[model samples]
Target: MSGLGMFGGTTIKYRNPTYTRDHGSLTLTWTDEWKTLGGCDLQEPTTGTDTKNREGTLSQYTLYMPSGSPVADNAQVRVDGQELQVDGMVLRIPDPLGILPYCKATLKAWKG
Candidate 1:
């Protein structure tokens, strides 16, 4: 409720704070919506799949976690910003594409 002419005009500028959706499901604090999901696509020309039998590209992937889901249950969590040190926690991005077309992440807890 700051700028009045902010729909379609050149004089539609405001001086306020800005934020982004970079913090998906990770920021569900108030409600049960904490921690969202990211997207990933898989198609042909990446996984080196046979163009005939095993043809495959970037496999679509998103954020997925169940409630009461133990972080040790083959969970693939991509930790950003700050890193935590846990005795039974392991974070890894299986593919090099991070979250491009084809990527895999495995955040599991190491059983020492």
Candidate 2:
């Protein structure tokens, strides 16, 4: 256990693509699961240069979950019945020595 009771007593719906089956066709199925103690933190926008040396603002968000929580890449996260975009990448912050205590995921997205 992380021993950190900062779940905020709320849950978030996690949706991910399961599989596709058809006659040479692509079918996307979303699997939904309720994750406990899920929290989201929005960070201040950061100014950075783009590939063309153009400055842009990037919004950051950190999603908190319990240790050993199953969160996949490109998964759709819904909080309070609203979907939020998870951009860039999903990073997992584990405990020391890869132990399972608590974990946090950082991603970038725009405000919705």
Candidate 3:
């Protein structure tokens, strides 16, 4: 599996959310300590809704990470196990004669 097709597609588990502070109350708790890190690729979700989140329904996915792949910034992805949360800044696509540099995360989930 080395044709560079988004790391051969479908296989994601990236977790980076550790901020715990609850003793005097400042409010900051996001504990997700999962680390699997594989040839990630998940792109098949495009549902939207607005109007001030009428009932809530937004599913957007486009996660294909491999280059450097540290995945931080609202990071929490676990495909095939169902757990998606990473919707901001993970875009790092640079392959200007550098072989393969790919990383684009934007997986949002909301259903109600």
The candidate maximizing lDDT is: 3
Model 3, position 24: C-alpha lDDT score: 65
- Using Cα atoms with residue i matched to residue i, what is each candidate's TM-score against the true structure? 0.16, 0.50, 0.31
Single out the weakest 10-residue window by summed lDDT for candidate 2: 48-57
Alpha carbon lDDT of each predicted model: 0.25, 0.54, 0.73
lDDT digits (tens) for residues 1-112 of candidate 3: 2445347456677667666667866542455567777777777766544334487767788887788778787877878877878886788888887787788878887777
The candidate scoring highest on TM-score is 2
Task: Write candidate 2's Cα lDDT for 20-49 as tens digits.
Answer: 888888765675564533543433335531
RMSD of 3: 11.7
Per residue, candidate 1 scores C-alpha lDDT tens digits across 9-90 of: 1111111112335547332112222242322211222333223344432232222222222233222333343221122222
How does residue 104 of candidate 1 score in lDDT?
A: 25
Candidate 3 clash pair list: none
Off by over 4 Å in 2: 1-8, 19-59, 97-100, 107-112
Off by over 4 Å in 3: 1-16, 23-42, 46-54, 72-84, 87-106, 109-112
Ordered list by lDDT, greatest first: 3, 2, 1
lDDT of 2: 0.54
Q: Is candidate 1 or candidate 3 better by lDDT?
A: 3
Indicate the worst ten consecutive residues by lDDT in candidate 1: 5-14
The candidates, ranked best first by TM-score, are 2, 3, 1
